[model samples]
Target: MLLRTLSCLCLLSGVCLAAQAQEEKKAAIKEVTVFLKGAELRSESKVKLPEGESEIVFTNVAGNINEKSLNVGADNGAVVQSATFRNNYLKDNGPTPRAKQIEDSIIYLSDKRNLLQNEITAIDEQINVIRNNRKVSTEEKGISTEELKKLLSLVRTDMKNLLDEKTKTNDSIMKLNTRINLLANQLREENNRDDDPAGQITVKFYCKKATTSNIVIKYVVPTAGWIPSYDLRVPHINAPVQLAYKAHVYQNSGVDWNKVKLTLSAGNPSEGAQAPKLNPWHLGFYRHTPVSYSQPVYNQQTSDYTNTAQAGAIIGNVLDNNGEPIINSVVQAIQGGIVKNGTVSDFDGNYILKPLSPGRYDLKTSYVGYKENITTGVIVNSDKHTAVNIRLQPTDHRLEEVVVRDYKVPLIDKYSTGTGRTITSDEIDAMPTRNTRSVASTAPGVYDGLNIGGARGDGTMYIVDGIQVYGARGINPSQGSNAYDNTMGNYVATENRGVNTTFDIELPYTIPGDGKQINVAVKSAELLASYRYYAVPKMDKDAFLQAQITGWEELDLLPAQTNIFYEGTYVGQGYIDVRNVKDTMNLSLGRDKKIVVTRDRDFTMRSVKTIGSNMKESFVYKINVRNTRSEDIELVLTDQIPVSYYKSINVDDVEYQEAEYNKDSGELLWTLNVEPYKTSTRTFGFTVKYPKRSNINL
Candidate 1:
């Protein structure tokens, strides 16, 4: 009897242990928070936990997860003991249904293309056979001349028909090839998920009693991110500019986000939140040659970039004054004296500044023993190449000179797109290392000084001369506060989380695992803007309409690509560079064709005279602004005089009429209120006295 009782207890313990074993439960993704460089996915499931120790395994999770970011929780008196994540290599996590369909379609198109190619081959063979018959007829023995003529005619007709059919078949094949290429491209985009095994998160929990408990799990994935973009629309010069903030969200996490609630955050989890430590800087002896002080000559050639709206590039060759290539020249695209993008010239002096948003930037090129040349107002268009040639002069060695050129706003802009979060000058100035790459790396999505995850190769079609081509924010948040305000827009809930700004989308979205961009509207607002017509007659005779908005900081904006719309017509693409914003933000609304501007040198006032050992050159520039529109307009005319960089060169007799003059930069700004059908004329003159042997470029 005692032996039987012990056997019964052993059986009961075995049953209890079996009941506490791990229970696999599939978790449904409930919500996702997409950051600038990563995303956090939250999933939940309900499972019954037996008394005492129990385990729950959540399967089919994101494979590209950051293991250290896993968090698990349970309800109904269940205490989480431990949790671990491991990749399920045995399970086959194949492509989604949509992706599979795309693959199948690609296969079908490829087969069709092969069949068309075979048809072309058969057509060629038929043409060859007809030619062979023609040759045989010509060599036939004792055939009548009329019979031979008829046979030749028949052969010629047959050959012509076969050739026509071949041409048609070739056309069909080309079309088929085009279709196949598109499908292949689509398949590639849809197949961008990581090849790692599916993830399984197992959580061990302790329960006081047997109960049904709800379990939730959350983790972060590095393969998902979003980029901000905008659309600035202006109804007219007097109306406000409508700002539409949007986000281009993308993910390749090996899991489809179907009907998942999304919250886009301006924070980047890839860059840790810990404050960076500063290292000591040790000074070393200067053994390298210094940069030259010679005068630089800049020439820019531009082409219209009206293709797909994507990031563009600036490509050119860096050469010396003697037309020799300057290898290892450092070329930078700068705005507000901050280097936004930079590249080093190759051995052949060829350099390509890529992935630049559509906007105007100053191109600065410098090399050892060569003077630095800065080309102001170089425009970059979207998906187009803009060429800018740099010619640096050799050092004169005798003269120690410093030249400061006045800043000029570009009147005409080319098309382009934008990316990269803006790092304010203040933030960079406070950093221990002020390196351009180091400072830009702190911005979201910038890794190792490169903007990653923003490249798109969708195999878009473009015809050029009948040829086809394919081309590619800091938020302040409270401490763990979840308070949000949804009064901004309908579909999105704007939340001012501490240290970050998040937009919680109200409606659920079906975002695929593909890494294609799906634009999501974040916020929209109509702010009061000041309008003025600006003209730099020295560079461009056309007048550009600019709008200035105050308190743009409240918009929580980052640097992004902007589409400009003026008077309900699409003007072009522009970039909102909020890195250097101050009291007001200015946006160019494109040029106004109705307003004409002209700058002419007054030869009558131009004179050169010798005074002792120095020569004095007098010059006068006249600017004319004609307003043809029916309404009165305000115009800002800008011009500049050369600033003396050396003590021997003196600028005297400066005369600017009703304009703001900056002595440091030698820039003259004139604001005029011109009425309709009226022409306004303004003149600014200056005299430069320099050494007789020295030449001044005016």
Candidate 2:
């Protein structure tokens, strides 16, 4: 009886042990709230925990994960007594099932190719055997001509069929080989050519009871980020520009964020929230020794707007007067008395504000150079997603009223992903340089646009009226002084000097290792400009039409390359270096072939004389201009004569017949009023007296 009881107890103990042991469950990625530097990953599992101290593990999570950033929790009143995290290194962190299937397909194709190759070899041998006919004996040659012809026909027929089969086999083999190679390559790049898979995360949780509970796992992983970008378009000088704000989001978190809620925060979690402490400024007795100064440093451990709807989420887009999406526009939902920070609009001008308490709130949206759009009341319901779209009007352009700007862009714009300076048309007109790059460097945080490594970031573009007039070029900056200070958040006025103008932007962008341009909306504007024609016949025969812009200084323009178009045709491109210009700035549109010009030297006016120890040589030049256009044309013909630089050489006999000559620069100007097919002529003469044997560049 005692033995039988022992056996029953053993059987009961074994069954209890079997029921207590549980298989590990995996947590599927539920949602991800991405920030600039990192992301918040949330995963859930329908876990079945055994009663009384059972272990539940989640395997195969992102490998770039910050283990310390991981958080494990449970629902259904299931308590997590203790939890531990580790990489499942013991597990074969191989390719996905799909990748393995691709490899298997490749192997199968390789075998198929081998079989086809063997068939091809057989066909080749058969063809060779048929082709190498046994040499006919002398006796056999004596057969009848009809019989020989019949034999030759039969051999040709057999050889042709064999060759066809061989060709088909070869083609089949080639196709199989190609497929095999392609699948193999696909398998090789399964993990984006990464050496090893990001190991699975093993989360061991200790729960008390066998209950169906919800598990939430969160962690931060690298290679997950987004950049702020935008597009701006304006119709006319008086019209408001349409700005499309956007975010280029990318992540290699090893999980697809398909249909998951996402959030973008201006707050940085990597940076500690500790306020900086100010130490006493002790005035120490200084010595006459060498010393250095440096800024204070607190060596701290370091550290996109996707429109995903969360509970109590507010989603919308912002636009301008023309109904165009305004990129990088700011959206704020102010509740209570707290001034809450809002999400900047994405490239499509889309914005999402979520995780809010149900209540009525004030909403505001603002764009650069545009009036703010404010909403007095917006009701947000709990567990519900609300929609709110905003529209802003552009500020009127009052020429006389100088709106002293405090920044090149909006205060929050520079914090977006990459470094780029936007110069408005007004700014370009004020400080005219040779190219967009030159003018861009004047922005507070900008530095030598040309020196920016990699593909050129979208710098300030040169626009005439509302058209993009110029292409890419190395436009060096003119004389200017800039004091730059940049930090984490977009600085409103950190170490500021000069015009405080900035592009109002939302997110920070990054240039790739290849230095590719981050497509962010830059500074742009429109100006009002007059047209005329000027020509230097002695230098270039073509007459160049120019635009004389007044009130340019008020425009605050920059030196940049100019794209010239005339009467609707693209003439050409030229540089505008305003550093050496006087009053009216002339922007040469392009050469006018309709106006012909020529400078001819007439030897008839030449005369030589020996004045004391020096010899005098005289010469004459005639500038001829003609109007090739059907109508009358206006032209300013110009020429120059040699000017004596040394006292030893004298130039006195300077005669101008139909030209105005400048004594300082030896320049002769002729304003020609030529009718259709009419000609205008100007004659100028000058004499140079120099040392008899001294050479001159005449």
Candidate 3:
């Protein structure tokens, strides 16, 4: 009985061992497959699993996949006994179902958090800009309280959304941790199973979670206002294309309209895409269409105002070198032969002139402390917009009058090259002088007492009627000074020094008296060669002889029409005639008709003389004259016997009760009368001495 029982126990034990072996064989992995979306799997063909835990790699599988979808099953109709999903397979191929859901939630919340952060930063910067703008004056700043409040509300909403996303992300992380721990515990228990003794017939399952947050940055460009323009083309493709339009860019978000930046792009969607593109279009070009949030056009029918013919004017800004506005600047417009005046610049250095007739105009600008500006040919095309920039140079306000006179005399005070003096016409009228020569002495650096540099002070060339009188021959002895003597001679003489002589001939009267006019020219420095012979007197007798012979003789004999040439050029012409002659016991006397050549300062006198052949005759007569020094002369009478010729001699009211003739030479002499810028003439007679005849002659 014991032997039979032992045989049955052994058979039952063997059967149990065989069943466990079969279960172990069924637990071994047979196949592996990975499903992936939006990702690539490593192998597309069928894959067989190894006897132990095996791994398969699925590259870049979608994060949404779950570990529960990955299963291990028997190839035949046997039950999946002790089935296991390897940890390596799960980690490399897919994620747990619950873990994947949590991960997805975290990713979505993280994206929301990032978006809120960006919005917050942008709102903070905008708020700061608004606050800074508020500090400006009411007139200078631009912005409204309503706009600022709206921006603040938007920022607050973005902050709330960010906080909500953070809370959601933390919850997702906690739930995913708890689910991963449970899955790990379940896998360990299955691996430790021991139903039969062939390696415990165990199966292990594992799942890994791979999660990532992706931020999809999408940019939706803000819509812009529409602008209309016309494109015109020529028949030839190579001809230039023309587009005509006007538009404006304006700030919409509480920013400065002038300071906003703008860009433009244009293309025809159906064509070959050759179109003009303008960037920063606000500054460069304009279309006829209006833009969003922009002001209405002042005059819509006039594109650039060329044809509208409205009254146009210039609005200008005047700025200093430092770009500061100049106040109280005088603005004037020269238009239609009339000057219209205006006043100070406004606070922004702006000046507006309205309703100006459309034509060329000159804008004259002046300021108290700046140089004047003249802008010319400013054409105001009926309602057109034109801009002119003016930059002023600094000047002293006190020097306004002197700066206005642009006349500059070169080298007036400079001491470099030449030496001369300026005698204004004002000085000529104010100074005390008897003649132009004397007036010249009042000029600085001039000497008239004596000649210097071998030239007489009076010898300095007299420029009369634009003619040089230096070497003029046959000049009247009465019109000008002898040049060697310090005094110019007088034509009329009187007893008392201070008495005005009625018989005195005015120097310039000689020209008009002879049916001509006298116009005096300027006087300048004279040459030395002309007056060298008269430099020294030989003796008093020689001097007296020269005075009587050449000086008085020439003054009485020439006519005004006689041409006086200087180096072969006809400068002037005139004549002088001596008419009446008288004979005395010691001298002969004559009255002369004098004529002067103004171009050369020449004068001459002419007279007729006759002698009788009837009887013996002789005579000696006394003559007296005055000198240039205002002294009287007494001359001696010497030869005899001509009582028959006494009727030809006459003295008509001779005024010299104080010795008028020189006694030695028996000639009449008188002080020469000099007048300013004029020529003087006088009529006087002198006695000539003669010897008595011994007997009667034919």
Candidate 4:
């Protein structure tokens, strides 16, 4: 009995030791919640666990993950002991299918190109041999004249054939070279990095008994993000506008998301959740000091609107030392130690850093296997697009570690449409902001758009110190901001979380690891809109058809570029800035040639007089709207009289017919209905009285 008891104890000890052994398993990404700046990925695996503590290693995960935001869970009453994340440099996350295809084509073309060059070289060598033997050797035995002539003729024929072959081979090589360059361009567009390693998650779990447990893993990655855009289509003037909401998703997060459930969140999890604190305000006398700045060495052209605080943009290309385009290279605009906006270079290596206030900024460009290039003192002038191309040098060694960086995109992309309101010096002076960036932010074109890094409220909720806090939450449906509607939730489900909105795509999507924009439909709605023709002849002589939509808040719209289509025709592009929308959402359709508008100064009513120390100038302007279309149109004509801020100048005797005039702004508006092939005219006159010592242009 003692011998049997000792044998049983030894067997039990052996079983326990086997159960505590470490096991490696691969996790499949099941879902992904992509934020404006980051993405949360959820993966799952099933593994058999033994009764004691077992170390489970999950392989083939996103290498660009934020380790602090990683979490692991298990079923079957398994208790997780510890979880850690590490870069798996050995794991092969092979090139994407498109990239592989391009690589194969390039290789095949390159081989052909080499073969053609070899053939050309042989042909040249044969030609040289024929030329060298042109002269007969005198030491050699004498030969017949007829034989010599035949030999010379044969050598000439052979040389001609060789030259012809060389020409053909050279042509083939040229064609192959062209094809190889095209394939290279395509590969760059794919933005595939073959050496991008996978990540691993090591989790230690304790189980009471041996059983198969379902394991779930979640983590946040900063390399993936999405941008919002819209398609606004109006069939005709009387039809309701069809709004198609879409998301432009992009990722470079090592792991390819194949048929994964996707959710797009407007809220950013990278932004700080801590509320900002205000410092104590103090009043002090103004100190005059001279400010100096170093000019950009590459570009020395000064802007004309710099003093007006107009928004500007920087457009450039990211290239390698060999002048090859570097796709998806991160470009950041840094101002005063803070990164203002960031963007990645396109497939063509072009990047646009937009909506920057007229000021000096530093540009930093980074890529995976290249040395970072920092260009300081890049001047962004008002109402201009500055070109600043950057060249990144390739690294000599492989990168063993991945460094994660935050990238922020501009709120307003003025360069896209080549249209934006310029803030004047007076407007900047009236603004409460003290800095140039703040003044630009307050400008009319700025939008509340997507960000790649930084934290925002309402992203994820957490419990801190037994108190509920708004923090990182992922994978759990209770915390997920998935959008849904009773009837319209088939393709996309939307949820309004007050601070931000989320669109959960119902269908499975296969977004590759390539850093390219994948368009996803979010929501579609046909909203009723009223149409009217508007024109400000003083500024522009063209009449624009505008669509006004009421109750636009229910659309859950974000600030994005909107493609306008009217009357079954594609119109110009416009911007939908939900942050600036109020009682009505007015969209401008393209100009209408059918409605002719003209503004002319009425010389008969214009007069100038000097009374004592004061000079009075009277100006009258007439605006005519001619509706040449078959249908009658309603036109709103607007003209403004100069508003004086000084007490010495006063605008008086403002006269108009059937028009509304604002007293403070001195703006005149006339709403008129004109029949087809008929014309309607309105005239407004105002008198400006000022001291004779001052000169004013009217």
Location of the lowest summed lDDT over 10 successive residues in candidate 4? 450-459
Error of 4 at 117 (Å): 5.6
lDDT (Cα, tens digit) per residue for candidate 1, span 90-132: 7765775755776676677678778878888898888888888
Q: Candidate 1 or 3, higher lDDT?
A: 1
TM-score top scorer: 4
1-698 per-residue lDDT for model 2 (tens digits): 99999999999999878635635666677566555545677888887766766666575566546666778888876777755665454556566654666766766777878888888888888877766662352146567878777777877899889888888888888877766666655555553423323345444555555678888888876445444432222222122322223333445555445445444433345555588999999898987984322322222111122222322667888876556565545576776533232556764569877555578888877543566688877888765668998877655432221111113332222222112233323222232111123321111111222210011112344432222222211223321000111221241211212332222233333222111112322223333444446777665676765555455454233332332222212222233334545566555444556777888889887889897789999989888888777776667667787787899888877888777878899877777778989888888888888898889778
TM-score of 3: 0.15
Query: What are the Cα lDDT values of the candidates?
Result: 0.66, 0.53, 0.29, 0.67
**lDDT of model 1 at residue 426?**
19
Candidate 2 similarity to native, TM-score: 0.41
- Candidate 2 vs candidate 4: the TM-score winner is 4
lDDT of 3 at 185: 43
**Tens-digit lDDT string for candidate 3 (488-565):** 223222122232111111222111001011221111111111100010111111111101112222222211111111
Candidate 4 C-alpha RMSD relative to the actual structure: 16.5
User: Once model 4 is optimally superposed onto the true structure by TM-score, how far is the C-alpha of residue 408 displaced, in angstroms?
Assistant: 47
